[model samples]
Target: MLGRGSMLVSSLFPLGVSGRRAGVLALLVWALVACRRAPEVSSDEVGEESSPAVLTIDAMDNEQHVLRGGFSVEAGVFRVELYEGSVLLGEALLEEGRWSIPWQPGVGSEFLEVVAYAMAGTEIRTRLDFQRLSFTEPEGLYAAEALLALPTEPDITTRYTLDGTAPGPSSPVYTTPLVLLNKRGQPAPLSLIPTNPDTSPETWRWKPPATPPVLATVVRLQRFSGETPVGPAEARTYLIGQGATSLPVLSLVTDAEHFFGHDQGIYVPGRMHDPSPEGTAGWGTGNYMQDGKEWERPVHVEWFEETGAPVFAQNAGVRIHGSGSAALPQKSLRLYAKEDYGPESFQADFFPGHPLRDFKRLLVRTSGQDQQNSKLKDCVLQGLLRETRLALQACRPTVVFLNGEYWGLHEVRERYDEYSLASHHGLNRKKVVILEGDGLLDTGEAEDAIPYAELLAYVREHDLSVPEHFAHVEARIDVEDFIDYHVAQLYFGNEDWPENNIKFWRHRGGSATPGAGDGRWRWLMYDLDAAFARGAEANSLGRLLRDERMAEPFVVLFRGLMTSPGFRERFVARFHWHLDNTFAPERVLARLDATVELLAPEMPQHIARWRYPESEASWRDEVQRLRDTLARRPEVMRRLLQEELGSP
Candidate 1:
């Protein structure tokens, strides 16, 4: 016979025993089982046999188990242990016989295990089970009408939404493969509109819809056992495109670890407030894809674009080039193709068979200044300078993609360096001397700024009004290039000038002739982001030229040249010529309108991604401000010039 406690222990483990040994074994088993159960006595009115503990997973019938969800056991479970393979994930205490856990599985893990613990009398019981799962997202471009079959397992149902909305239980259930299409409908056929009044009818070409067909879908899937939901819902986005555009797409792809992980990544803006250190050292290696072809070589890429997007999927790199942007967020970027880093040349057909194809360094400029000026300031300024036979960098606009994501519009610009001078002027890179606005010598054998410093000293000490001094100043610089450079900067009201954003290069051996090895300083167009109305009023340049408070060497040189009758005459004549021809209101407005039209379709996405304006109307208002500036600036500049320098 057994005591009540002994009978309870015997009932818990079903041990058949007799005499003193049975009592001893019962006590030992009772103590062992008691330690695992809750101290508080559990209700037994329902009877242990009547409501035996049962553990079950409601939603885990799928092969790819999500890392989140709910679990249940028949009203008596006190604790649940979760694990990924052999690694213990965590434990949860059940409330009212149910427990929910947020399962955070390691990247690439495919299996999960759950163990539920319940107390019956003095015994602790457990139910162990496992589920297979994945969190990898689907990638690559998809066409319209393409069928996408999602990975699944038995008893699992997937829900998805194509309108870029998050999927929930009420979303459409996935019964079969999804057929993607332009839910908004096929794009209207393009109409040819002649932009240039002078353009012949035969020259007009069909323009594709400015906005391409893009679809982004989110999928949420859950496993179910009969009517009960199991595990957590797993969700991811699928980005698809209908067709490729004529515009080249530059796609950069990298591992999540390198891109999102801490240390040595571009996303980490270490010491952003200071600009003392020449170059911050956080570069990652990634593959560059352009025009549907991939470059397997590892390129050192960094987060370059700013203000628009945080953690831009698209990065910047140089191929055999050096580094060098725009809006406050629409800043500029530089890329270098150094020999030690990777490939020395970007031999793409950017300008097929042209000298630009083998560029050693490139500049990516954001026309943030254009938005403030006329939405065409930099492009129009560069074009005007080129038309006036001035040496200026060439630039073209292209849409950029980062890690297979659209990164808005960017202009590919020629970097100002020894290589640029060599390529443009057919001069030897070793013999080029480039001087920056801050008086630093960018490239040369001599580290000192002897040549530029001497020129500045000469202008300050001697009276340039004298023909002899004026002749010497002209010898050191191309007089025509200097006049045209000043005209462009002043006419556009570029406030960030003279003291900053200046670049001048000279060939060591050439004469003043174009492409000659003779050395005479020529200005380079740079940082027009601050031009137009962003930094200066229409008459700001004229005011600055006359302001004695401006004491920079470039300003001093300009003031000195203004003292000479011949120099002033040439300057006034050149200004008038540009105002009438290059900066003509009709021509400039036409270019502005064309740029606005080209960017109209793309702006919505760009603004949406960057969150620049409060609303689309605000963006239009900003663009209108540019147009208003363009409409009013030419007259303001003409009036200022007439008042300050006297009418030509």
Candidate 2:
């Protein structure tokens, strides 16, 4: 979006142009702009302007120095010049009706421009037509080496930066093929205090690590004509020599100012910071806690497969994600693909075999509440319920980098929003209504909360023990979907639920269409970081059945539904079916082991960077604890369920 007119004279500056006029410089700017518009040639030198010359580039041979093209005017003699960026690639005179230049493009040249000039009595008559040629190469992950080349022209020069900052006038000029090397070194040491020694408590907070910079090379460059930039700045990230891992890798590059600047930075405690009193534990208010459009920053996103093959490279908008997690040293980031940034959606098959490929938004999560415990807990727990009818975020573990700094292990997950609902259930995004907790609408219009409110009121007032009353509730929501959702949460023992982290969605068109449009609400499963927090013998079923601290609507509906034998029968049947299958000890353990194995290689570095678990030993203990919890949960849950409603 940077405009060519605002380009700095020294070299290319990336586009996305926005500027304000200064009152004092307005007159001087107008005079200079008027002069710049004046013709460089006079009437006496070029005789008289008649017909304009047309230039076209037909084909560019990769192996030969034959650039073939055509010209529009056959009567007047004209000469054509081909350029890459201040580098004259080739030149030739027009012959008959066509022209050929004796030049070959560079090995990796991605773009080139051509211009034709008319001639009369040895003086240049007028600058005529111009054309450009572009090429796209197969881009993905790379292991060995990657070479990048930029086209050159006589008046245009290209400047580049390797630190992820936007190229400016003073940036290094692109002289030769830029080479990227793998320099991934050992992980940094743990930064910790001696007080809490057991396992790093999730309540304990810390400052951002001053670890070493990221090893991957992020190259950003732009071309300039005089003081004006030719086009938008381009960027690429190369992961040379970095060995393969079982998980994917994401490289996010942006200017350091965007993250650490006092006035505009989104990652730092800036001018707006209001810290809590000393010795007290609080996330504290800071610029990072701010939300909405102004806090969103521009970033370049690059996704690499497990084998170091590239997936997709694009420019996107990024914002600090989550409520309390945003204040963490290793915070979560929400990536957006808006038209203002670049693409409307990330056009790639990020998750293979999954029906949905293109994602409107994604989250680079730092394991949320489990960041200090086993980082793989949430993702692994979600994986166990993949076969359930509830809508769950797709979780994929990945290593991440920010502004060429190794940000440690993070999960690239699908975000819960209207777009995701549309993609997953084939519903119109505009017609979807998602509500969280009681009756708060997460998506759709304010009026969308009405249906959920009505359902909550009817369940709270009427007796669901009556067959007609229970049947009415079923008509308003996907009863089976709701059961599966609560069952999974209960099985996981997610202590953060019932009152918080609740989400349900329904299509507005309701009953007008099939599937999602049946006007029946469905639940979403997310934020299970608090799951399995208690030991294996924790009685989650008993807690939900007798606990009074839960939200009114959730408590009333659940307890009311249990009053009916029909509803109780179905809930008990579904819960046991999941225990026999989804929570099967072997199946759950196999998934846990596989997830741990995937993260084992990167844990040392992530631990050192965040000092989360304090040591690899602590992390392993937590993983073992999780394994033990899964092993005993089914039996304990079954016994608890029997005590509440007798034998199934």
Q: Which candidate has the highest lDDT of all?
A: 2
Worst window of 10 by summed lDDT in candidate 1: 284-293
TM-score of each: 0.57, 0.75
Q: Measured by TM-score, how close is model 1 to the native structure?
A: 0.57
lDDT of 2 by residue, 219-257 (tens): 787898766777777777665555665678898888877
lDDT of 1 by residue, 247-355 (tens): 3333333332222223322322223212332222211111110111121122323222121111211122422121221102333445656555445654443532335
Q: Rate the local accuracy (lDDT) of all candidates.
A: 0.52, 0.72
List CA RMSD, all candidates. Answer: 18.7, 19.7
Model 2 segments more than 4 A misplaced: 1-147, 179-203, 207-214, 275-281, 512-514
Q: What lDDT, from 0 to 1, does candidate 2 have?
A: 0.72
lDDT of 2 at 417: 93
